[model samples]
Target: MKKTCLNINATHGGFSLIEIMISAFILALGLLGLAGMQSTAVKSTIEIQQRSLANSLITDITERMQLNRLWLSGAGNSYSIDSLTDANLSIPNCIGSGGVFVNCSGEDIKNNDLYEWKQKFTGAEVNASTNGENGLVEADACIAVSPASGSDGELVQIVISWFSTVKSKDAAANAGATDLTNTCGTANAHRRQLSVETYISKSS
Candidate 1:
């Protein structure tokens, strides 16, 4: 009788239950990380949008101020704040048959033709309590203006403030989120301000 070699293979090269569970756990953790990243991306997008809007608001005010520097500086008394009315701000129904202008609506003056110039930034509800026709710090231009002689300049300060949807605690909890809080405990509000002491030379 020829004794044939009988091979009895006992090598189990497959993964054990513990190893499988561990791999599954690692994969699940990776997926959760991806989800968290997606959430962060969404929040970041919102922050960018808010930032852009704030920038646009500031630009709008500055551009208008520059364009109407005469009025901004009370040049013919045509552009004075006293003349600012809903009609001049281009508010519909504010002008009657005589085209006589009246006091600007609180909302109309606060926007500074931003509502009429562009529809994109119009109707944006700001922190009404903190923001108005006056500057962000509530400085009235009419009161603040004190013409410096021989300077031939009008020092105008333009301020833009908006409420950012980004929450503080949430931002702290998630490092990826934007923190919009200011030192004055004015959380969720970002203010951009600049003072342009432009000299309105008689030539120009």
Candidate 2:
């Protein structure tokens, strides 16, 4: 047998510089995407929380009004103020048997309820000069009522407005104005709103 010479060439394989750079770029892009998603999720969560709080506040006032239906049908009907503020809702401390917890009469209760409701916006004690609470900022509420038409019952409309973290040119342009529909018409894009309506029968 004749011996034949065998030549074997072995080449090592590894990533090139360009390949490494490409991988790094891809990783950076993925990280950026993840960061963006996280930011969006946080914003969405905050918005949901704000909406839930607004709903709760609305429900609270609605229940209070229902409880005092008698008063709501009478002098308390004035509760349907177009724009509500702390001054208009002010009331003296509870008097008589119930003390601070329970108001003395229906009117007293209504007053107390209004005062408390205003506090939710101002986030301070009745006598506090400034808002110290971390609740909604610059929150406002509007109440409108239409008298019963035939047998359709009385219509009550509630609108709540609050300032958001976002800014809008339209909102900023109309700042300091008294237009409730354009509450965010100032420069704040973060303005949010919630509105609800209910009917109260004359019998109820």
For all predicted structures, in order, the TM-scores are: 0.51, 0.72
Q: How many residue pairs clash in each candidate?
A: 2, 11
What's model 1's overall lDDT?
A: 0.42
**Which digits, one per residue and each the tens of the lDDT, describe model 1 over residues 4-45?**
998998977989999999999999999999999999899777
**lDDT (Cα, tens digit) per residue for candidate 2, span 61-164:** 88887787776666336456665653576565665444555436767887777777877655565336553454666677777777766763567777777776
lDDT of 2: 0.68
After TM-score superposition, the amount by which residue 180's alpha carbon in candidate 2 deviates from its true location, in angstroms, is 5.4
Off by over 4 Å in 2: 1-8, 85-91, 95-103, 121-134, 151-153, 166-180, 183-188, 202-204
**Candidate 2 local Cα displacement, residue 148, angstroms:** 1.9
lDDT to native, each model? 0.42, 0.68
